[model samples]
Structure formats: structure tokens, C-alpha cells
Target: MKRVTGIGGIFIKARDTDALREWYSRHLGLDIADWGGVAFRWNDDNPGAVGTTVWSLFKADSAYFAPSDAPFMVNYRVADLHALLAALRDEGCNVIDRTDESEYGKFGWVVDPEGNKIELWQPPEGQ
Candidate 1:
């Protein structure tokens, strides 16, 4: 099984999310929306194949990246969240004990050796 298929998203914590969002929108032309993020559509040439990569900024005090003092987190696309998480556990990685699922897809987390929380996602079928 492939450990990581691709980067699903990159999340950064900022002291002032609004200011950072404005900076990215004005300087980087990111089209940052009210939600403080943008989804970049995958330009796949293959028919019936589509995907997107998400970029977002979170407030400095946000607990989303909890258990880690890092200011950033990376979400990785995975083919099978359950299997991959199991493998990480067997390999002695500090896998988080909780999982979440929604219309978006199944989600799980694991903290790397350096204590950076990593998000694993299995996108809903056809996403």
C-alpha cells in the first residue's frame, strides 16, 4: 500500500489569520475566501479523474494542531486510512487514537517523531 499518495492540504497557523489571508490574496493571488482558504483544482488531463488541493490558514490559538507546538500541519492523501493508520501503529509511530468521518471523507491523525501532527484523509469516492 502506498503510504502517502499526495499532499491533500497545507495548513498554517498565523498570529492574525485575517492579515495573513489578505497578504496571500493580494500578494500571492490565492483568492482566499471568507473561510480563509482556497481549493486548487487538479488539472488532470485524464477523463473522469479530478481532485483538489486545499490551502488554509488557522488562528494561532487553534487547537486543530494540538499536542504539537508547531505552527503548521500537513494533510496527506491516503488510499486507505484504516490500513495505513494500522501500519503506522505497527511501525511504532504515535498514531492518534481518534478518527472522524463526514460527507467529506474519513479522517485520522498521527504525530511524527518531531511532534508535528499529521492529518491522513481518504477522500470520499470520486472526490
Candidate 2:
């Protein structure tokens, strides 16, 4: 048997493609080049290092999330949790930033104009 390497890309449908592209570019600074897909670099380290994962966010009612109708979850690795949250808020985006050692590392979430939930996370130091 063989194992998978990593996620290739994430694709989603939009009523207004151009508008959504601009929204992501403005709010998240993601470069939606050809098909509104952003390439993000992941962290690979020693001892429980999560590889680069491409996560997509969709509406809770959308079929993309799951067959049972649940909110989409896309956890993105960010460099600075505070700065990212601040920048997102400055861009008029609703950012939820919370940190708890018991849980994961610093984490936050933001919704795009299309009502997609985008999660942001900052792993513990060296993780």
C-alpha cells in the first residue's frame, strides 16, 4: 500500500468569481492567480509536525463541507496570530482570536464575503 503526500489544491464555486477573488486578496492577502487558489507554505519540523494542508472553507449549508451539513473548517498556518487578526479586523473582517494552551496553539477565524469560514492558527513555538 502507498500513502498520500499532501493536498494539491482547493476549488470552490462562487456566484461572483471576480468579487470573491478581490475579497480574498484584500482581506487575507491571498494571491488568487488563475483560478482563485492561493498557495500556502506549511511547516515541517520534528516531533508531531503537521504537513502542508490545503483547506477550503464553504458555507455551512453548502455541500462542500460535509454530507451532514456542518460549518466548513479550514485551519491555516499563520506567522503571527495577533498581527493577522489585527490586519483582518482592520480590513473590516470579523476575526475571532482565542488562545488556550489546553487546546491547540493561538487560533482565529474569519469569514469571507461569500460567508466562508476561514480559520487561522499559529502553532506553538518550534511546532
Candidate 3:
């Protein structure tokens, strides 16, 4: 069970998502997309690298990072979201009882000991 393989994304909560996105773009040189985030492809540095690392901003009022009042959330790439989630549940981890699937792939969540929500992602095939 190779748990977390890499970071899928880093999400930050801000009072104003648009302003924050602009700041990140202007100051950090991030190419924020119209979708409100940047996807850093991996193959550029490692030929075998697959998937991307996403950086996005969310409004502070957004409930996406709910159940935990943290201002940030970290999404981690996983080889098997279902299996890993099950393992976490069996281990008494605070695994959320929900899962999502779309063109993006399967997604699940858990709250760390410090109450920070952690996202687990399994990228779509060929990603």
C-alpha cells in the first residue's frame, strides 16, 4: 500500500479568491488558469512523471474544506483511493464517508490529527 505518492494540489482559502489568485500570479509568477488555478505538469522534469500538481484558491466562505476550519487543504495523489480510504477507516482515521468520481477521477478525504482536511486523488487514466 503505497499511500501518498505525491501532492495533487495545494488549496488556500482567502477572503477574496480573485484577489488572491491575482497576487499569486503576479508575485509568484504562477500562470493561474481561468479555472482559477495552475496545473504544474510533471513530465517536464521527469520523463516518467505523470499527473500534475494543482494550485488553487478558494473563497474563505467556501465549504469545500469543511469539517475542519483550516485555511488550507492539501490534496495527495494516491494509487488506490478506495483501498487507502478503507485502510484509514480501519485504522480509526477520520476518513470522510463520501467519495466522488468524474472526468478528474476518484476523490476521497480524511482529517488529520490536527484537524486539517486532506484530499486524496486518483487521477484519470492517461493523466
Candidate 4:
């Protein structure tokens, strides 16, 4: 099975979320949104193929990256969430049992050996 296709997003915990966001917006020209993130749209080599990679900031104490205690979490795009997650579980990876699905995509979690929480995302059709 093909594993990670690409990076879906990069999330960082911030002591001062607003300040950091503004700094990134003003200095780095990130175009941060009201939700404190930006979606960078791009195209694949395939004609008309488009996708988005997100960059977002979370509060310092947010439990979003829970179970690993990491300050950052990386979301990897996958072709098939259920299949890959099953394979990870079968391979003895620390795959989190919980999964979520929404308009955006299907989501799952896994923890790396170094205790960093990893998010697996399969974007909605045509994304």
C-alpha cells in the first residue's frame, strides 16, 4: 500500500497565538485567516489536480496533540485512511483508535516513536 502521499498540514503550539499569527502575517506574509491558519493551494503534475497544505497555530496548552505531549503535530495526507491505519496497527505502530470524519476529510491519529502525535488525513473527494 502506498503510504503518505504528502504533508497535509503543519501545526504548532504557541505561547501567544495571536501575536505569533500577526508576526507571521506581517513579516512572513502568511495570509493567516481568522481561524489562525492559511491554506496554500497547489497543483500536482497531473493536469487540473489541486490540493491544499495547511499551516496553523494552536494554543500552548491545547490538548489537540494529546497523548504525546508534543508542541507540534504534522498531518500527512494519505490515499486511504482506513487501510493505512489498519496496516499501521497490524505493524505494531501506536495507532490511535479514535477516528473522525467531516466535510474536510477523514482523520486518524498515530504516535511516532519519539512521542510526536501524527495526524493522518484523507481529503474529501476532489480536494
Say which candidate scores most in lDDT: 4
Candidate 4 colliding pairs: none
lDDT of 3 by residue, 15-55 (tens): 98988888888998999889999999875434764679999
Give per-residue lDDT, candidate 2, residue 44: 53
Model 2, C-alpha of 35: deviation from truth (Å): 34
- Better by TM-score, candidate 2 or 1: 1
What is the TM-score of candidate 1?
0.95
Candidate 4 minimal-lDDT segment of 10 residues: 41-50
Query: What ranges in model 3 sit over 4 Å off?
Result: 44-49
Reference-based TM-score of each model: 0.95, 0.45, 0.93, 0.97
Give lDDT per model, in order.
Answer: 0.91, 0.55, 0.91, 0.93
TM-score of 4: 0.97
lDDT of each residue in 1-127, candidate 1, tens digit only: 8878878999999999988998999898899867779988784543576777899999999999999999999999888999999999999999999999999899999999999999999988876
lDDT, residue 60, candidate 1 = 98
After the best TM-score superposition of candidate 1, give how far the Cα of residue 77 lies from its true spot, in angstroms: 0.3
RMSD of each: 1.3, 13.0, 1.7, 0.9
| Candidate number that wins on lDDT, 2 or 3 | 3
Error of 4 at 75 (Å): 0.3
- State the RMSD for candidate 2: 13.0
